[model samples]
Target chain A: MKVESLVFMLITFAVITLITVSLFIKVLKNNKNSDEISEEEQ
Target chain B: MPKNEQWGTRVGLILAMAGNAVGLGNFLRFPVQAVQNGGGAFIIPYLVCFLLMGIPLLWVEWTIGRYGGSHGNHSTPFILDKMGKKFFWKYIGVFGIFSNIAIAAYYCYIESWTMSYVYHSLIGTFRGMDQSQVAGFFSDYLDVFTSTTGIPYEAIIFYIICLALNTWILSRGLNAGVEKTAIIAMPLLILFGIFLAIQGVTLTSGSRGAVFDGTVGLNFLWTPEFDSLLNPKVWLAAAGQIFFTLSVGMGSIQCYASYVKSRKDIALNAMSAGWINEFVEVVIGSCVIIPISIGYLGIDKVIELTTTGGLGLGFRTLPFLFQQWGDLLAVLAGVSFFGLLFFAGITSSLAMGTPLMGFLQDEFKFNRQKSALIFGAIIFLMGMPTVIFFNEGVFDEYDYWAGTVSLVVFALFEAILFAWVFGIDKGWKELNKGAEIKVPYVYKFIIKYITPLLLAIVFIGATIRPENDDWSKLSFSGWELHNESIIGQLIHKGIKYNNTYFSDYFKSEVDGVVDSVYHFKGRDYILISYIDEKGLTHTVSYNYSGNELTVNLGQIVNAGDIIFKGFVINRIFYIDMARLLLLTMFISISVLVYIAAKKRKQEKENK
Candidate 1:
């Protein structure tokens, strides 16, 4: 690939990876919070 | 309404939403638009529109869906009724339902084409075929089930199979069907896309003896022509691509969002989905198609193919390139490529159908399976004409109205309702209800003012543009005329030749005639007559090949005196009339829905 296109591809991958990780972290945190809330109520 | 179906998992919901956004357009349509508009320069406007239009609309639709879902309403009409205080606002929401049904009818047929092509590729049907033969293969496939009347059985069968698959999955309810498929399919789509992109860029030789690096194609895509950014057409193209690639304007996004919990982090999810779609489109999509074509056929041939519309590259041109590979490798590559397309097509097609399914279940309280089956039948029956008569312009008509015009109209309505009617403050709060990151405050004005202004410009500019007005015009080689009837008038006066007629007519040569009936067989013709700005009457005829003939009327014919022949025979008029009638029917239905809603309100008040 051309240098420009290669750079574009790398940047895109980096952005997607960042977003995916963030989403997973948020979901995990939300699940943990819900579990803790339920335990406290019980 | 079955306690308002909710997504089983956050991951599954995001995957399904991403699958909805990532579609055939990502691979096929995006690269072509990018190359045609301004190559790498196109990305500037594209990203600008993504921020200004795509992301904002994504958040808007998600917020609308979640808000409506909280109130036991999933479809657009009821969703808008909740968002907008006035009764007339729900009537405006009717465009959403109309667009989804119209789009799904043709979209399902296109999805079947991918499935059929996948099967064909696996069997090596396109192996060893030349370019013309490959083109002929696609043409012949279109005619395979064609008949004089009713739907072709071949098309009907494939379409039924496609619809049945979608219906069965949708009927499985949210978690088991759409979500599961998305979780599986979206990952495979990305993997397949990466594999193809790698293979495309690694090519070392052309089939016809050209030696080149695949980076040449990459350079062609990324190298910017700065001048094109100044054109309004490029801006519109960028906005349109953003809308299509993100699958924003179609009520599908909102429908999927409706299944999310009201307090879910819609802002981050919407941004992630948008970025995922853009990754598939710009990085993977641009890498796969252009590099492969350029590596196999050279840059010149690829440029020639790009002018023929993006679908041509996917359907006709790339199949020929696949034939140039080693035997086992060729088969493997062909199957994988087409299979990726099939997965992409099915995911998006399913999203198109889901909103209507939501409507049936939420509003009418129909069972999920029953609604799925009924809508499946409706979509199948509606798609029959396009399947049977695709070459006769039925598909194009549906594509133009639903895919192009209605999308913009519905999107414009959405922007207006969210920004102006719902109040930007409320919309922004809804968007950030459970957000992981806050949206920039500048978008407050952008969504309220700039987004709708941009959409209105696109809509109004498209409407006032005369180029699309002449739906009947067969072709134009020179001297642009807006309508097709003028060409029919030229044909009536014995202008039976092409470009030579223009020279001959201007020269006043009465005897310079070319007998070319062989050229005219099986071709649609049109006559056009117009008075020039200088008050001189000119008449012309042409065919689909862009051949033109200028007729000499012997004496000066006045502006209204021009007579047309063969123009009335064009099938485009019938399609236009049908579209007009369909719009009329939608308006009437909108009025009835308003009355019904008012009556329900009255009944509740009396009680």
Candidate 2:
């Protein structure tokens, strides 16, 4: 594969992966905190 | 919302929302769209639109949905009514219900095709078949008359089975039904997608009848075309793809988000869902179809294949391409591909049902069971016409109006309602209420100004798409309405069927001598355009086949002479009937919303 295409693919993929991963982690973290609170109450 | 219908887990809720967004469009539609709309550089406009339009719309839907849910309103008609001050907003919400049922009717039909294909794959029906035989199975399956698959009415049977399955699942209500299905389906969808992508990318050029390396196709997909950013059509395609891929414009996200609890972070949830859809579309979707096909057919052949039809590439071509792998691998590939599609499709179709079910349960005193049954029945009744009359362009008619036009129209109106009428300040507050993460402040401006402006442009561009996709040629001065515009579509602009003649007739270039005239097998449209002396072109359109005309087979016709003229409306009746059916569906749903509103008023007065 050409370097240009490889760089382009990497950049695009990395950008989307970054966006998704960050959000997903936050969602999981939020869920964890919510769960912890409910469990503590219980 | 139902007492039992709230999210059992945040993970389940996120999975279901992601599942709703990450659908067949993410895999099947996006790959074809990216390749056809300037390949590698398409991501530029795609991501731009995602920020400016897609993610913003997601927040809007989620905000409004939770707001409605807090008010005990689950469906769009009531939800929109709760959000917007105007009386018409509730009526405009009819698109949410109408588009879904109308779309679900056909969308489920496609989901059935995936299910049937999975069954066939596991049964090893395609084990010994060559490329043509495997490809031929799709058409043969579509022909309800043909018993080639040894099952009579295989298409209809699968469709019924699919609908029954959906009804059964939906009948279980939120946690057991949609959330459980999402938990099962979404994980498997990602797994299958990853498996296929791995299979695609690792493919060797000469290992198993491949003409080129799989990585070469990846290169073709990601190689940037910096110039494509300048083209309006490319930007529009990216916008449409973003709109559809995220599944925003359809009221499904709103319906799903409406189930979220009060004080939960809709902002983060919406962002997560939108980004997950992008992950599916950009990474997994891009990797599978094009790479595998190019691994076998070469890039040129794959590019050429796109011209036939996007649907054809997925259904007809992929099975055959997978056949290049031997028996075991082929079957596995087929199962994975079709299963992922089925999962993707069902998730979205399941979302389609929620809005209607929400409408029924919240409005009428229908239980979840009754609502699911009624929704399924309505879909079955509405869907049968498209199934039975597939050849009369009825299916395409439903897709064109409800699937494409209705979604855009609904989205545009909702954006206006959210930002302009609701006041972006309050809308922004609603958006950020109970948010887990800080949404960028720039989105306030984007949601208010950029998003709606982009949607309006998309609406106009879609409603009156320029002939040949060149905006420079958009002329409204009685130039024949032979485009994708609503008016053009209403007239069934140009003969879409097999037998038709359409071309520019340059009178000045032609000697007045008679040229050869040909006979049409059937239908309306032998549109002949000729330029006048003043350089203005005049179009003479006629349904010559429907009339007794002087034009005959092998007859000579002079330049600028209209050989045939009359109404060439072959399936215009079906088209009109289809439009009427959609209009009726819209009106009927709007009536239900009105009655529900009135009932709510009466009950409140009594209280």
Candidate 3:
């Protein structure tokens, strides 16, 4: 039971991390070459 | 002087609000509930709520804030007017403020629990506490926590400390006060949480593998327990989990959003905050609670402990587990765990305070400092019952009424008001104006259909059923022992049964399981069936002798042994799916951003 619970939690972490990282990476990639916006635009 | 100010930056708003949204409940309640409910299975509903409802509602609140802009100070009234229902909802705006005030009172009392634990740890009071002793200590601790005749000095001190901390930050205004705290505290929380998780997993018992293949550990947590899901308890828990954990339906989110720069991307930021909140609150929290519960109490006890008497599981059960680790380790674990808990509570209290602070400033036009202090005093007074009152479970009532039911209803109301009535067209313009990345049309669909519908169903399920009051009565059988006198023990050795081999084989399979099973009468029997070494099916009745099972075989059947390999495969599949979906969303976003960047670059080059 303990093993199963741990594996599940680890898997959950992995999933959340993967999604978070992926989304983050996408945001980074999209914004990587873009010019910074002025304060007015922001 | 500048009326209400925008957050100096988005990051601070995210942190402060996130800090408020994430709490001890998430860290404390979520994992225990997951562990006991079937680990992976619970994650299914949890993740569903996160994506479908939590994020979208966040977007709704943010949209309201940014669209109203300077006028957003009066969130409920402003939105109601815009939606052409100023009369009805003007009063409802107070719901969030009222809930925050009520919650703030009890929140301080609860936060003081951490202070007590901190003081006790430093004094080494936990050095000799066993499970029962620890429970007794907590009961006694509450006596000092809540004063009967007026406010107790100790309670006053901590209450003052919490209120002072909140007031000082508000005086700095949003940038210096809320944002600065969020940036520093949120990271510390994550780091501390990660450090504790590492320590917990490294412990001797924690690293050991699971007990059962299905619905018991990793697989059980994710694997859909359709049977359990069908029950109202599961649905209600899932709803309450979403409501409380997100810190929604309280106007808190709206208050924070109100300060956001008009051009900031509501959808993206909301998604980011919601995503981060769930990761810290649900995922990391589960990491801490599950392994510890499984290591100490076994799977079944994890369930009972989770469902035990409101939110006292963290205070009562965790201390007992800490004691089991012996003196040095126990003290260290107790200090570190509770220390992490303290920060989590403080951050949440700060977050809850923001909405109330905003409402006060907006409605009454008081400066932030004065508003925070005046409201802080009110919450402190209201919190006395939660701290001092023992019999009525005042804290639990506050948690259920304001935290659970009220939050869900308010959240639903907010979503509908924003998406349908307030006009998504205006919201879209506000969200996309300065957004570096445009929100997809899909966000509109989700805010309109997906988010509202999901919340409604979950709310109905959560409120329609009576909550489980006595979750402690549940128990599981591991061994059968007859409690007899020394002489009577000898006489019970002659007890007979039909299938004796079942007990013997079962005992042999498990080396030294705990004696959890108990017999009803002097002599009680159980029927057991399994395939033998030759792959022939057999049935037997077993009479438990002392802590042993004596099986009596009734038939030697010739069917092959039932295969459990499929259940094993299904378990792996669901876990992998959850992981895949989470990763896919993240990766897909990254790839799209990359493509979008390339497209923009090409356009720039041509220009």
Name the candidate that leads on lDDT.
2
The CAPRI class of candidate 2 is: medium
Question: Which of candidates 2 and 3 is the stronger one according to TM-score?
Answer: 2
lDDT of 2 by residue, A1-42 (tens): 889999889888898899889989888878888777646754
Better of 1 and 2 by TM-score: 2
* 1 versus 3: better lDDT goes to: 1
Worst 10 residues of 2 chain B by lDDT: B504-513
Task: Give the alpha carbon lDDT tens digit for every residue of B486-524 in model 2.
Answer: 777865675443223333221211313223334532343
The 10-residue segment with the lowest total lDDT in model 3 chain B: B562-571
Q: B74-172, model 1: which lDDT tens digit per residue?
A: 778889988897877777777776777777888888788788777778877887788988886776567745422233555566778888999899888
Give the i-RMS of model 1 in Å.
Answer: 3.4
Query: Which of the two candidates, 1 or 3, achieves a greater DockQ against the reference?
Result: 1
TM-score of each: 0.82, 0.88, 0.71
Q: What C-alpha lDDT values do all the predictions have?
A: 0.73, 0.81, 0.60
User: Could you say which candidate leads in DockQ?
Assistant: 2
Assign candidate 1 its CAPRI class: acceptable
Give Cα distance to truth, residue B148, candidate 3, Å: 16
Tell me how many clashing residue pairs each candidate has: 12, 2, 31
DockQ of each: 0.32, 0.74, 0.21
Error of 1 at B422 (Å): 1.2
- CAPRI tier of model 3: incorrect
Error of 3 at B91 (Å): 1.4
B-chain TM-score, candidate 3? 0.71
